[model samples]
Target chain A: MKNIVIGRYIPGNSFLYSLDPRTKILALLILMIGVFVIDHIMHMVYAIAIIFLVLLLGKISIKRIYLGLRPLLFLLIFTFTFQIIFNRHGELLFEETLYYSPVSIALAAAIGIFWFFTKRFIKFRLLYFLMTLLAIGTVLSLTLFPGTFATGRFAVYEEGLFMALFIMLRLIIIVTLSTMLTMTTKPTDLNLGLEQILAPLKILRINAEEIAMIISISLRYIPTLLDEANKIMLAQASRGVDFEEGKMKEKVVQIVSLLVPMFIISFKRSDDLANAMEARSFAPGRPRTRLHVLTWKRLDSCVLALSFLLLVTAILSRVLL
Target chain B: MAIKFERVSFQYTSMDNKGYLALADINLSINKTGEFITLIGETGSGKSTLAQHMNALLQPTEGRVHIFGITVDDKTKKQRKIKLNPIRKQVGLVFQFPEYQLFEETVEKDIMFGPKNFGVSTEEAAKRAEKMIEVVGLDASYLKRSPFNLSGGEKKRVSIAGILAMEPEILILDEPTSGLDPIGRNALLDVFYNIHTELDKTVIIITHDMNTVYEYAKRVMVMREGVLVYDGDPVALFSKSNIDRWNLDVPDILGLTRDLEAKFDYKFTEPPRSRKALFKALEGMLK
Candidate 1:
């Protein structure tokens, strides 16, 4: 149970792993901004291509990326359905009592485009060009197609298509950039980067050390909590607690039983951890030496520079073109 | 004065909402001065449950536990009202796999935790910690190193030192040598012996290993299904025939010695606790 979640971080000397955490974080921020600035299929295509190229260089497996996407499948489907039903601005391809709108079609297209780009980012093993092309196709399909089903209901397919493309491009860029950041950075380094970034809050008498401790504890416990949840589920299953056989309310009651035990165990572990920490003289305000130091190299600088250039170009294309 | 339990009964709550009686009515006492007392029982026999009661970590559902004539509940309430700092200062407990209790990044800080928590000054805590580190036979160089990084035996020793730093009068250890290899177990036994002989601290150990009880304990307590069935000298306890009825085995050395005495038709005046003692007894008989 403990080993299951911990095995996510593959140990390797890939370029992605070697890049500074701060650089990755900054690049992620820039990409998210660039995603919002994109207004056309061409720009969306370029953004997807860049993300794919980064994933290829990172050496992360496509299977692992797909696995990451498994958790978000429901959300993706919901977004697609919501967008398709609500879009009213597009031309009606079929007539029915319930007329589909151009707006709904554009929204569905946007969702599809975002999903495709996000999936590519998750499938980090795909060839750079292939992932980029898939991302472009997603954006184009979303932007050019309106979800209207009614015929002769004042159609404006070109406007709906362009709008859908624009929205899809934005979403694709955001998801790809965020996924890339997470896939490339270690949690520990990310924590250190957070500490460095939040250091300015020290002026308000807020202790950075305490905040860092909280972050570190949260990071450490998430995997632990998941492991505990898994065990509790297994224990309940062994005791004839069929979670799948129950109605919603019954399932909730069963879940409550599992959660109660999990919470109890977590609290006990926390108390033990506290005692252990105290015994080790881990008091607030004490200066401690770090074993692993974060260093920024030339590669980090180059990545940061390229990310900024992309952001500037994205903005220029939106404003000037 | 030392730890004593008077007619104590405890009931454990099971997952199915049923009560499992852990310890039946029992009376036991230990002196303040150094003495090794071993409690032996099978799994679910209340050996561990009984040990927890010694330090007031768990209160008896019935009867009373007295530490140096002060009832544990009385002390617990008083400590809660004012603080438990004093009671905790006197009775230190080293739990099973005590190394897991280590939370400090450095060994020195971990050792100082108990002392500091009890309101000892930083300087005094450090001094006590240094003494404890030596007492546990760990090098001073370990002071700066992380506790988690230490070997299993070393981690156990560090945990023991953490308890000792508080200067507890009575030390309760639950399965101290459990999960250790033979050599590690023997080395730990030596450490316990040193604590008993040199420090004069009252020590209570919970174990099921008959040989350990026979060899080391001045007094042996046998518990069966949470009932204190026998409390007497180790030699006399081993000689009893009804032991098998209680699902208990005599120590291997004692069994061999008893068989020899039966075959030879001459009584060995003293029952041997170890191979050396058995050899010495044989030499005397031959002479």
Candidate 2:
């Protein structure tokens, strides 16, 4: 819950924070398109640099985004492995001939068992996770040798490696860009910005402002709800639900125990909030005044122009080059 | 001692906060039986942190906390062999608005959940559930009903019953009576009072209510800015001349006793512990 950095607005004043949320959101959308167009490694290197620059502009530490990425570790590793195994391209990076006899398989099985027990004692989870993946990769490469377990070809291709790195980089860019937008923009300002972005819906009788308010309020409460979940988790921990010591079935039961309380409490909370808002005479589908209105300044326009330029160059490189 | 803190301190680490010192160095001891202690402090005073340390929910950052017989320190954390859940079963902690934790389908199942998790047989847990519901002042009929269908006060009782069903030797409640109406609060307090008297468990309650302090707390421990500044009899706490320094309101009974002493030109070596004690003192003055 603490590592959920997206939509977690840290209070700071800087170039990114000062940019209009509308501009930031639009720029991120454009940059995402740019990311999809750019297939070259050099272009990705540039993109990574630009991302760090944006991080600097936003006054967000690299550590914050790094922590945010931890939850995606499994997905990243899975995708990397999937791409490397399936996508055969330009040149072979490695070709190996190996055998998996009954004895060798038993040896690997022993190592697997060793890993299963030793994994708990290791505190550095990321390194351990990667080591486990390496073990899995080794297992996948092992094949039934013809006639008394002879050696077989195990291989990797150059473009397969490139593509795997590219896709993972793409994922990180997408996640980081969105995180940047959320980290800088205040929820209320994000709401107003969303209203402006969705203003075209007014022609179809849709209330963009109301929809935006709902979106931002829910986003604002994500962290609050997470904290509530943590508290409830601790309370249940006290009741002898050993989350760390549970079997998979018991873990599911414990998690269900957590979610039920979260659902009930969050519903009660929103009910109280709705009543309080009504008591304060808040009316939906009515003319509303803003405490602080969103503004698009000259700098915001410049930022948007730069994003548009980036998008054009990316498309040109993808199509023409 | 059931629990002992030796120069214990705690720092909270999160995404943004590298570490915030929530509890500073503190030393304290709690007995295993028949001790009713109230932990009182202003908000963010580390009272709750101290309470958490009892069951190893939050271990010390700087020093060791001895719980039952197990010691928690840097070494224990490193080894990670000794399970903390056994300690949890011994020291039950009920957080504020514990009603929010009521999740089981029926009230009986909810109460049984704790004991069953601690490895009690289902039948035995059910029997404990039957006993605990009544201990929290609920009728046995509540056992069959869905806990979600209960009223706020009833839900609160059900949650506390859930904790009690485990039959913890030490019970810690964090502002257990906060949201209840006065009548409901007193009734719930009486439930705990009876538990203290009958079961003889070491009960620690963290509260902002000074009146409960005056009434039920045999001893009061005051926390300020992550430090335990006072630990003694509640009567001695109220009698302190600079009581305002702790930002505590003089409990109503104490205020009335003070006024009675001023108006009647009476002084006793020992201050009255309760309204009934004040009444007896007043009778003695008249004589």
Candidate 3:
């Protein structure tokens, strides 16, 4: 729960903290779109450079941003593997014999058995098992299949490798930059910014203020709910819910044990909170004056314009280059 | 010793990445069995942090902790074979509002959950659960009911039964009766008393209730701002010249005894710890 970085605002006085919340959100959106539009490798590097600049200017600890990415490690690996395996472009890197004889098959089988046992007993079973499977695939390609050790038969494409790296870098940068925005910006300011940005949507007869309020309320509750969930988990852990020590099957039970109580607690809290809010005369959809109306400054405008200019440059590079 | 803390200190990094010291240079030890200990402190006095160390839930940031002679230090963390379940099994912690831990479909299954996790066979675990239900004063009929459907006090009892089913040698409760009504509080305390006296288990309670400290604790350990300020018998703790300096409350009966002695010529031989003992002294005075 402590590791959950989304919606968590760290108090700071960096340049990024001074920017209007709407500008930050808009800039991030543009920057994310810019990352996808860039086709060349050098352009990707330029995009990464821009992200690093934002990260540096934010003044948040890089270690904290890295910790926030920890939960996505498995997803990142999975997606990278999927892109590498399915992609078949650019030059072939190598080829080798994967299966040559019955004896070699038996050796591979022994290795597979070893891998299976290790996966079953290890701490990070999913990650270890996936990597082991990939290793076995590579070894099988090397020994079981009849081919030269270094030629183009069974191979890895350069484009596949580059695309995987590109995807992963894009994901990490986008997540980190967005997280940095929330880390530096307070929730009330973020809500006001969101309200200001979406106020134009009112012309379409859409109630944008309500949407921003909902988003802010939910964001405000995320850490509180996460805290409650952590308490429940610890309480259950003391009862011998070995979350870290269990087999895959036991993990399912452990998750249910955690989730059910959290569900009950969250629902109970929401009901109580609703009653408390109603008692205090808080009615939804009412015209409410903000305590801190967001005032846009020169820095916010400069940052927003620079982000837009960067987005245009990225699009031009993709098209004209 | 069941547990020992040697120059233990804990530093916590909250979500905001600010570090705060929760416990500082704490040294303490507990007997293996038949010791009823109460930990009294103001909030943030590290009572919970110290209890967590007893079962290796949280290792000390500095120095070492030994739970039943098994060292839980930084060096042992690298050795995966040194499992914490053994310590956790022996030192059962019933957290405050332990009822929140209940998640099994039935009360019986919830009680059986802890023993099952410790690798007890289903049949044996179920049997222990039945025995624990009786031990906690819950009826056999409650075994089939959903734990969530039970009343607040019943849920607390069932959750406590879950820990008792593990048959820990030392039972540690953190504010066991905080939100319960008077009858419920006494009922739960009676269950703990039975476990301590009849079963000969070591019971450690973290509480702010001075009355509970006076009536039940054989020894009281007091903490003030992450330091152990007092450790001795309850009588000695209450009678200290500067007991109020630590912001501790004396038990009502003990306080009343002192006030009565101040106003009258008759002298009470010694301050009694409980209401019944005070009343008995008064009866003797009338005779």
Q: What RMSD does each model have against the real structure?
A: 19.5, 3.8, 4.9
Per-residue lDDT over A1-321 for candidate 2, one digit per residue giving the tens place of the 0 to 100 score: 465666678888899989988999899999999999898977887888988987887688998788778778789989998888888889999876657566556656777787788988899976886787577457545664333365556678999999999999999999888888888888788778889899899999998978987997888787799888878888899998877778899999899989999999889899999999999999987888887877779999999999999899888887887
Q: Please write out the lDDT profile of model 1 over residues B53-154, one tens digit for every residue.
A: 765656787888887656865245434543223555677777665433565568898788677656689999889888888877777898889876787778
Against the hidden true structure, what lDDT does model 1 obtain?
Answer: 0.71
Model 3 residue A284 distance off true place after TM-score fit, in angstroms:
1.4
Over A218-304, each residue of candidate 3 has an lDDT whose tens digit, in order, gives 877887888777778777777778767888999998999888888888887889988999998988768888677677899989998
True contacts kept of each: 0.00, 0.85, 0.56
Highest lDDT model number: 2
Compared with the true structure, what per-residue lDDT tens digits does model 3 show for residues B1-287? 88898998888877657878888888889998889999999999889888888888887888899899799975565677688777888899988775469888999999999999889999999999888898877889999999888877788788888998998889999888887788879888888988889989899999999999998889999988888888879888888878878888878888788888887767888777778888999998889
Superposed by TM-score, candidate 3 places the C-alpha of residue A158 at a distance from the truth, in angstroms, of 8.8
Model 2 chain B weakest 10-residue run by lDDT: B268-277
lDDT of each: 0.71, 0.86, 0.83
lDDT of 2 by residue, B81-100 (tens): 98898999999999887655
Model 2 / residue A116 / CA error / Å: 6.6
By descending TM-score, how would the candidates be arranged?
A: 2, 3, 1
Model 1 chain A is weakest, by summed lDDT over 10 consecutive residues, at A1-10
- Candidate that beats the other on TM-score, 2 or 3, i.e. the better one: 2
lDDT of 3: 0.83
DockQ of 3: 0.50
